[model samples]
Target chain A: MGKIFDFQFMIEIIPSILKGIPFTIMIAVVGFAVGIVIGLFGALFKIYKVPVLNKLTGLYVSFVRGTPLVVQILLIYYAFPILIKLINFKFGTKIDISWIPAVVFMFIAYSLNAGAYLTESIRASILAVDKGQMEAAESVGMTMWQAMIRIVLPQAAKISLPVFANFFIGLLKDTSLAFTAAVPEIMGQAKIQAGRASRFFEAYIDAALIYWGLCIILERIVAFIEKRNKESA
Target chain B: MSNVMIEMNNIHKKFGNNHVLKGVDLTVNEGETVALLGSSGSGKSTLLRCINLLETPDAGDVRINDYSFTASKINKHVKLEARRRTAMVFQNFGLFANKTALENVTEALITVRKKSKSEAIEIGRKYLDKVGLLEQANQYPSTLSGGQKQRVAISRALALDPKIILFDEPTSALDPELVGEVQRVIRKVAEEKVTMLIVTHEMDFARDVADKVAFMSEGQIIETATPSEFFTNPKNERTQKFLERYLQRFSYSI
Candidate 1:
């Protein structure tokens, strides 16, 4: 074999991959932030079973979770422009579809997928807060909602942090799919550079290394939070 | 003539096929401490919970300070008025694990009474100090001992300045040594002339502190008397048997 590894090849792609880091981090951060909100609301809806809204949230979670992230990215990218046109027709006005819309669509897809899993995790942790604690709050003449907000949710968040952190890391990795919509995130930029230079193997390896580094950093943060929670508990 | 603080008239509660409280009637006068002594599943806890509307009674009326809470004939406004005057402390220390001891105590004062944070904190600090936990004000419940947590729960109830406090076996979860600390805090509150309805098995504490004692058996009050009267000369055979069983089981001669 010529060379098992090529240091020069790896070194050449470093600057190009570094250039895409901001985009990669942006997609991950935005996707996780949006997903957390959706997950919290979705979990609350399922917990309370708020009539029609509950059923709709359940359907959204199942639909998003049942399909693959790759398929969702492709569908959101392709359907977004057409959906905007239909909305324009109904409203009797034109609406432009742009990069922001694509990013938003990709964010929604990733977040909702993360949210479905988080909903279950959050709901379970909320239940684990103990029934006696609730009874005690009520005995003190607190209304149901007040007790849930002041007493229950804070404790539940402590329990939910680990699972939430795991979902965030997974969401970060899934940002690779944003490349399909020409979002030009790290993976997409690496692929474009590799195509131009005919160095596909080198480029993909760089992408893998970048992803591995991010996951390691995220894992340490999650571990630290979990340790703190345990010490407090 | 003692002014009636709380009156339960023919209160009944049923859970599916289980008849928990069968027309249980009890009353406590203003500044009176009534100990509801009973074996497990005798509807003692259920009666206390019903007074605060934590568990709604199926039939009969609970009147606190002349405000009837029975939903049968009274309007919604009347029921809401009565619930405001009562508060409960649970068997397990129901301190909010997330909040500091001071925050948990002041929450109701801020939310319900519309007291400012500074004012609520002042009131909360007084009650916490009364319970001997003012130093632990900033500590969360998860860090406290069983007795300290229960004391915080007591302070939370007292911060509302409720007319009546219901204690549902407040010291049941405490270590044997810690039980006395909680009992002393409760005893101090009793001395302040706060009307209380206590469901407990702490016979000596109940005997020493209670103005009246009501013994319940199979969802009914089988005996009601002053502590001396009940312990010395129990009227009903059921009360006699209960005293005998406990006195023998714990090997304590009364």
Candidate 2:
């Protein structure tokens, strides 16, 4: 809709951007999966106040959340290999790092970002579950871990579903930063197409529309799942 | 002598500066129904929770059936084994909100007891039926009435076949009309001679179901007596006063 934006050029590059959609989606999904594992451990440590690790988790979450996502992407992309090398050098280990994909680095960075935000969500949701639920499970002879996994986490998950959905949507948009790493996600495709045509605004608009459409589709699927879950629950 | 099912000796618990259970002791024999009565803040619930090590008493000796350990010396396996020997029915029902009534009843049976799913379901059904909730087994806790939820919880407890069942003010959270239904289920359980230790404000239910009623005040058991003798002829002045204050409105009902 902006002046000097060529509608024709936007339509032409939309196909190119569409090709990058899979990369965008793949990273988001992989990031989300990795993020859940990190978030659960971080949240549990924070909840239990597990000595020194809890303090470290607090600092990790604060640092990740306080900084910009793009900075994290660039910092991890450039600096992680150096840190890995230092660890290998000191430990006398020959962990091969060269074979890792560029997108794997994106996965690591984005997951850490998503994990920090999700740690808070998971902690709040777990706390929000009724105390009695844990007691009831333990009362019936469950170990604490069994009670948490069986009784408490399910209820907590239901409470945190909306937050999870919002985070996933946010993660999709955050995938735009992956373009900085030369990962051919939606925004990466747009950047390449716009650079070729020298028409940045139109390509970005096309990419934006695709993201909007994907989000809408994701939201619909979530709504439908929620409805089915409600019926069963 | 009858088998001793649960024994708490010199149990001591503190919440920072607040001392809730102060060197308290009680014994529940097999097939005994001991009703614990106390005014609020008397530490009756805390004492019940100590039986399962739910509160992790600062100091005490707990012996639940074959597992015995000083509270401070307990390891995870002994603690869990002792817990496995007893089940608690909480005042708020405490039904797993995510599980159906049947699942709640079968959870420990399948997971802790290592029973087959079909076997657990069959056992779960029997207990659900015992509580007159066989039809509601598929329903979630949120959908059931408070009475139904508590009944499902009772079935859950019964399904474990625990050495003892601990009730922490089981009917206190129910609506007045709903109280009778759960009380009926508990009464039925008591009639079967299942070992039980219940904390309750219901003086009449205590008198009706408990073989002995123990009075607790300020983190100590003041006097324990047979239901008839305790209700009609309380020997302790503190207990007499507590009963007088708590029973004023229900004086004629008592």
Candidate 3:
């Protein structure tokens, strides 16, 4: 308790944690952006039931959603190396993978998790759009795909924005899991500093505070978007 | 004149166990306004939907302009061409809620016809002005009242400039006072020589604007005639019973 307010210790560690902010932000932004792509494809596949692809997409979504995200991150970072090696033997080429591989793996895992949820949200919103709208678009010389893209998706997107934003913030928090891959994100750096200086309590507290602050800001932004959407609607 | 702008041959549709349209046949000449009148579930709306391929007929041929669309035998190209020439307006004003009224009107022009944005907007504004919704051009669907939304929907259909426009109970969703505004818009379009197929309950509007009226019942068109003949001297007993029942329900003089 007496060591909790070690001002000099906190001052020294602040810069180290701040240095990791870029990685933290990168994981969140990239993961979420990729997640949206996955979500859009997942949604399209599920809604249209495109031959064999729809079943494959369902399998992927179910697998991703059924597994815990933390286990997924670990398997992607660790077990994936052995899988790649096996594939490399089959292809007869030694594949040169980099740290980028780990980042991409993390992105895939987080994106897929968010995508499963987003797909459900998008599908529901799309179903809620009146069926007459589709008939009207079709009658006006627009093909089925044209009606989906130009008419149905736009209205469905407005309905889905709030849920999408919430998923984005969840993806941000999930970035902390990337540290297991030795990615040196904010949480990783804080843990490293705490280990070296024997200040685990102080370092972890600061990390939790930063995460809470980010969540608050994201919530505000989501609220603003929802309000604007309602007013426009 | 072309033999027919639209020809429906033995159209039949069923939903689950219920028969909606049963062995119905109809035809519309070029530049004609045909009103389909019936009690609910009497197949008026289902017939209109079938004509546009919105509701696939369980059995029938829907010939529009030069293309023939049959639910069982339609090829992709035939379906495409049939859809391209026909336009429909719905009872609930199915405007895309996210887009401005003008954008909703212009979406097909740009997406399907490959018109430039500026060109589509120009065409959109023309049709919107035609429907008397020019002032509401930039407004979203949520901003408009029921009648205004229907007007915008009318403009959207008109923007395609299709060979014919089908209205499925166009004024049914509007307020009692607001129904006349949408009806007037439809009347104005009809006066401009636009070919139309309307399913409606507005007996007065049907009488005044329709070149022909088809009365449907129990999944069949029981009778069809010029509005005066249909109203004053309906031949089918079912048609007379329906008109009498409708007049009684609405408490209006027929």
Model 1 misplaced regions, further than 4 Å: A1-6, A98-101, A224-233, B72-83, B250-254
Model 2 ranges off by over 4 Å: A1-5, A80-100, B251-254
Residues A74-98 of candidate 2 have per-residue lDDT tens digits of 9989897898899899999887778
Candidate 2 has a TM-score of 0.94
lDDT per residue (tens digit) for residues A1-233 in model 3 = 36657767866787888777788778888777777777777788888888997998888878887888888888777767787788889999787666355667776667667777777777788887888777767777777888888888887887778777877877888889888888788899899998997888778877887788888988998899889778776
Per DockQ, the best of the predicted structures is 2
In candidate 3, which residue pairs clash?
none
**Model 2 chain A lowest lDDT segment of ten:** A1-10
Number of the predicted model whose TM-score against the real structure is largest: 2
Clashing pairs in 2: none
Each prediction's interface RMSD? 2.0, 0.8, 1.4
Candidate 1 residues A73-152, lDDT tens each? 78877887898889989998766776354567767667666777777777788888888777766666567777788878
Worst lDDT 10-window in candidate 2 chain B: B245-254
Question: Candidate 3 chain B — worst ten consecutive residues by lDDT sum?
Answer: B74-83
| Overall lDDT per candidate, in order of appearance | 0.83, 0.91, 0.83
- Candidate 1's TM-score: 0.92
lDDT of 2: 0.91
Per-residue lDDT of A72 in model 3:
83
